[model samples]
Target: MLSKVITIAQQKGGTGKTTLAVHLALAFVKYHNLKVVIIDTDPQGSLGKWFMVRSKKNSLNKNLTFKTASLWGAQYESKTFKKDHDIIIIDTPPKIESDARPSIEAADLVLIPMTPSHVDFWATEAIIEIAKKAQKKVLVQINRANQRSKLINKTHEYINSIKVSATNIIIGNRQIYPSSMGEGKTAVEKQKKSKAVEEIKKLSEQILLELK
Candidate 1:
């Protein structure tokens, strides 16, 4: 089987790109039973930091591995990593830059996480363009959505207005996500029965369907 590359990207920061990358990696290993590797292309190294916590806490999954890539390049890095893993999840930087393009280019599917706001939706155009230039499929989602708000419908329309494929699943803004991550735990380990956990499980299913 070919290794699938899923790049979690958004042109703007605070759009929950890293969150998606990390959790999706865990979901693939824990729920989908796939060998997963996370490549952090973001200079911020947020994913790497979490992996450190996992190692320190002994929570690291043997099936999941983490690696970091330089901002200077990635086309070569992506190709090399896929040789060993079932899924190569790339966490790209929060901008459309020389670095992010190669990561998006290397993706089989690029996931754009948008907050439920006009600004977040508007920020997606440039990254989506880069993904299209690379001819990669994209899935847009209202990530960290305010579950109690009515704007979810508007966000859906906005995503569609831009002619991008939108996933029916939306991730909610919940304290549990970060709290669990801080402790080197994922929803699968901490809040197995919580709403946040269910959202991630659904996201994995939607993502699989999109990949098909």
Candidate 2:
């Protein structure tokens, strides 16, 4: 079966882009029992670092694998990994430059993770336009969100003002993400009762539907 490519991307840095990628990869591996492959295209190598840490521990899934590559090599890896894995998640760079384009173009779906702020909200236009130009679909995911906050509600209004589609789930601001990632574990394993785990699982449900 051809693997579904989901590229988590954002033009601005620190929008929980890598967090979303890591959580989703873990969820797919632990919950869905799918063989997932992660391609880290970020120059900072954060995703690869996380995978390395996870590698130190006993991996939950023997079939799940991760590797790093430049944007130039991502296209080849995207095509190559699908033959052996059920899904391929590419963590692209934090810009819309050539480094991010290759992964976005190879994506079956590009996830735009943005925090609720004027700068973060507005930055979506560039990446959205880039995805559109690539003739690919874009899905928005609200990251570092708090549902009860006025800013969160206002951000909802902001999203409504835009014409793009987004996931119904909200990834609330929580410490479990960073803490769990540090130990190479996901929210599901580290903070089982926390809302953060629910948010990740909920987002993946919508993502799974979109992939179908």
Who wins the TM-score comparison? 1
lDDT of 2 at 53: 84
Give the per-residue lDDT of model 2 (tens digit) for 1-212.
Answer: 53899988888999988888889988887767778888888889988888778878976756578889888788889889988788899888876665677888889998999898889988888888778889887888888877777787777787777767788988888988999889887798786666887888877777888898
What CA RMSD would candidate 2 show? 1.5
lDDT string, candidate 1, 133-161, tens digits: 78889889788888888888888788778
Which residue pairs come into collision in candidate 2?
none
What candidate 1 gets wrong by more than 4 Å, as runs, is none
* The 10-residue segment with the lowest total lDDT in model 1: 69-78
Q: After superposition, how far is residue 105 of candidate 2 from its true place, in Å?
A: 1.1
